[model samples]
Target: MMAQWHPIAPGEPLRAGDQGPRIAQLRKLLQMFGDYNGHPGPVTANNNNPERFDAGLQLAVESYQRRHGMAVTGVADKATLKELERPPVDLARQLEVNAKRWDKLPDKPGKRYILVNVPDFRLHLIEQHRVVLSMKTVVGKSSKRTPDMTSKVVSVVFNPTWTVPRSILLTDLLPKARNNPEAMHRRGYRVVKYGTNTTTPISDKSIQSAARGKATLRQISGPGNTLGRVKFIVPNKQAIFLHDTQAQSLFEHHHRAFSHGCIRLQQPEELAYALLGPQGWDRTRVAQATTGDESITIKVANPPKLFIAYFTAWVDGLGKVHFRPDIYHRDN
Candidate 1:
């Protein structure tokens, strides 16, 4: 009696050295996804050498990991292998979804603009035809998600005042104030009560007494400020813009989507320089702007168009299809 063998289907995803009529079809698909625009190459069939994977295939896997902010070990571990084995059909579907989203982006080109890709956790400064600077970024959390919209750079605030949002004040600061009232004062926050129906303001002393025993106090600016040292204002209803974060350690992670509802730039000064141009402002000047006596706005001579887009699948400069995890679940 002979053992039975299963027949492989055409157009199915292939592992290394998966030979048959389907091999050609699989190879072509692999080529399409392999190194084209700084993307990784495809895996090769070298079954004889169990100790080492093919050079080209290993390179491709490593490149993919690097781009997605994954651990860059050349060996195809379980996670790497799983990603490598993603079906072509699935990849095509993601590409289509992202393409539709890209279509909705603004076509206008400003003299200088900042483009932030939320899922990719990166910000690109596009001036003329080139990307002036590229850096890692942290976007809004899933709950307080950063909205996808466009706006112009109104002004750059140096040593800006941090106004606490009602949401943060109620959920985060209030709880903390309950724990320790001095803690709020130590952090440069002043509590205030406002009229329920009107925009009537309350005095600092009144707010202090109102929140004496209760933990419903609001904090203002200082080193513990959520907005860090500086904030870049954009005229939008979303009340979103690029700002510095105290949690700098998050930037080291590849996928840094951990903000409340704003975009956090890893290197804000670099972006400022690129946006401000010619009129050079050093770190001291930037620091002054962020922490000066009052908030100041520096208007650009010709502001560049800012586009905050979400693209999970794209063909890199090398023509290879680069697929990233739909971190925001925007594809669905």
Candidate 2:
């Protein structure tokens, strides 16, 4: 049976120095989640030895923080306490929900494919059912969620231009541009005729006309480009594709869900080199393509299948079950 424990009282956060029945409780709860496995039984060695928060427990707290996408400060802050307060999900229930989702995957997703686990904020490049590469990814925000779908990655574009989506242009960009008219030129953006090569200087009339579908706006290829150094094209109906980003500090956060709809990659070049294969694409070639302010495209000889999937919980190869928050609230 699970060990009986008292409730942790609300107060200041628990750090490494504090010790009491609450410390013992924290140890027990962390153990339940597989983040703490230091000793068998209670933390107290004996009545005289009472519970004491130490380095071992601190390490466990950090592990819990990492898994939950919280700041890895190794301290039991209010946020950490709040997460611990929630009743732990039964292991059987987690497995059941994950199993149902796993059943939907293809029996064989080709010899090469990319698996994006939305809730986990991770990307796994698989070859022959084995993970060859894994990287952190910034997914869509809760308001603009990344959809689940299967597509094929066909090409890699270096020094890519950013075409401000009509929706974003109207809702987000235009409003900001209105306040700062020079925002267009300063950000390497230009107003132009939709689907045409002819370019015109930015003006109030053009901006107003673009809002009415009479013109289009796109950012020039440069360092300021929001798409960063490269983009991986995955033809999908949602107009979503994987690409590099200028705002890379987001990766430092354990929980990375700060994009409009497209997924932002941490190490996109590694993926580009892998997908390009040996035919002619390599580190040196990729560097040359993205080195300057020129748009370049390299078509892969064989495109890898892309699978954007969702699963809140799963057991890893080591038999340890991992769980993630249902950011999209699709589990209910």
Candidate 3:
């Protein structure tokens, strides 16, 4: 059955009234994924208008979207295309590969656990087997793939300063800083001596020296901060954690693998409140901590355990099958 399937690579969404070979491609994909029961019907029929997008096909698309954790718009959108464009053989391979991953999971994850499935670009807060909270996440780019690990969100830092990582300095910002030192300062950056917090303000001359690798730079906490207003410190060797992002607009895109190595949350405040509320932190206090220039780090005495998993395919507790694109090509 998989051998008879072909890939569907539409450049745009296919709605209810669309027609052409793309529609047939859509139907065949939906059929291949078990979304449509009229397999041998539409696929095998010799009708002259087999490429028409009828209402039944639209319903099938919605079913596929809903099961795959996507917006059920009844249109073949990019997220849907990312899944359907894959040949059936690859998807089957994902199931077999992910099954081994699923087996490694502990039978009892805990009363509460944070699950960040990298390929799915989503974070779910599970409490007693119920998904009490879920949100969109921007994960590491392909070049710096987010690693799978176990850790605890040990602290929540409010109004955190962005200490520019050394790799990012050389690879991303050094050229731009050399181009315009003043603009770099205007962008909330300060050239400071490496490994020490210099209290005095730095000069433009220092910016050039910093760009030339004489020193390091850090972004002050202010408007448009790189770490946004908050940072969740999940302790692991990789130094990866979940945090708010200044580029909140990135959450609106369907494909959200854009971070360097951390997971950027769409609704970080919600997660923050969830984590700190039990520790007697109210929303008013939380909001206040996030404001102002001073950085505050609150230690979590009982932090929630975090599990970052990489699964291209898995079945949700609700029995809905979910498959994601092999963005890092790990599904061998």
Candidate 4:
């Protein structure tokens, strides 16, 4: 005989006092996540069938949503159900991969510091034992390939000048220069000419012809700058740092790894404040430090420890495993 599906048996006018099978299951689920106390008062229509889907259950759902960066509507809708029903094996696999990656990080202590997880596309500002602030971030594209590494932030550059990378100059800008030299200059790129034996300043028209013929050329910075208003200088071999990007629209997306090789922050100023707070440096002082003619290095009184880790799976504080999409395909 096949098992029969039943209506859980409270009747059409089920009240708060009713104890149905559905309500029992809901309570079990909440307990799994350490959220049993969320039920609050008696289950009623005012709180959306509390006996079956009570306030406690809703709060549990909201907690899950917040951790995963989802809308915390407190109702288990289609998306919520899908997330909740994700296979445990998959979550375990992600956690394992990220844990291995975390094992390869450096252990250094400072007063405060910023850490960015490229694959996860998030940033954390850690101060002492607590995570002071967290924000969404955009990383480099697969082609540009942002590398995972660590370094000390030496200084911040405001209204900074950008030195175009050779790869971009050869692949992207040179082609455009061949077509219109003026376009490069109008957009703040300084063009130069290189001969068989020496190099000299060149006209836009000349650059265009040379680019058309596949000659090597480069551009210097101005208005349509890739690095927007400011840049955080971190001394590392990868030449990567936290910089402002003109492409602010990318932040609206859930997955935001779309840079050349640097981590673009959603809230660079707030991060600046957090990092500099222990040093007794305010916004005005930090801004002044970056605006001078030369790059300045302001050593923190006590540097903060940073962990740029990639974890797709992990047990939360409640001991329930949380899973995230492996956007970088690092596990595979």
The local distance difference test score of each candidate is 0.65, 0.83, 0.81, 0.63
What tens digits encode model 1's per-residue C-alpha lDDT throughout 188-228?
A: 66654453222222344544554454323443445676677
Per-residue C-alpha lDDT of model 2 across residues 1-332, encoded as one tens digit per residue: 13453346676788876778788888877876778768444555432222577777788889888766677899999988987775544545766888999999999889999999999999999988789999999999999899999999999999998888887888888877777868667888788788786666677888898889978778889889999999999998899999999999999887788999899999999999888855677788877888789999888777889999998878778776667888898877
| 293-318 per-residue lDDT for model 4 (tens digits) | 35344454444544555666656555
* Full ranking by lDDT: 2, 3, 1, 4
Clashing pairs in 3: none
Backbone clashes per model, in order?
A: 15, 0, 0, 12
| RMSD to native, candidate 4 | 6.4
Q: List residue ranges in candidate 3 displaced over 4 A.
A: 1-14, 18-34, 37-52, 66-73, 76-88, 199-214
Q: After superposition, how far is residue 244 of candidate 3 from its true place, in Å?
A: 0.9
Please report the TM-score between candidate 3 and the true structure. Answer: 0.83
Best by lDDT: 2
Ranked by TM-score, top first:
2, 3, 1, 4
TM-score of each: 0.77, 0.88, 0.83, 0.72
Candidate 2 vs candidate 4: the TM-score winner is 2
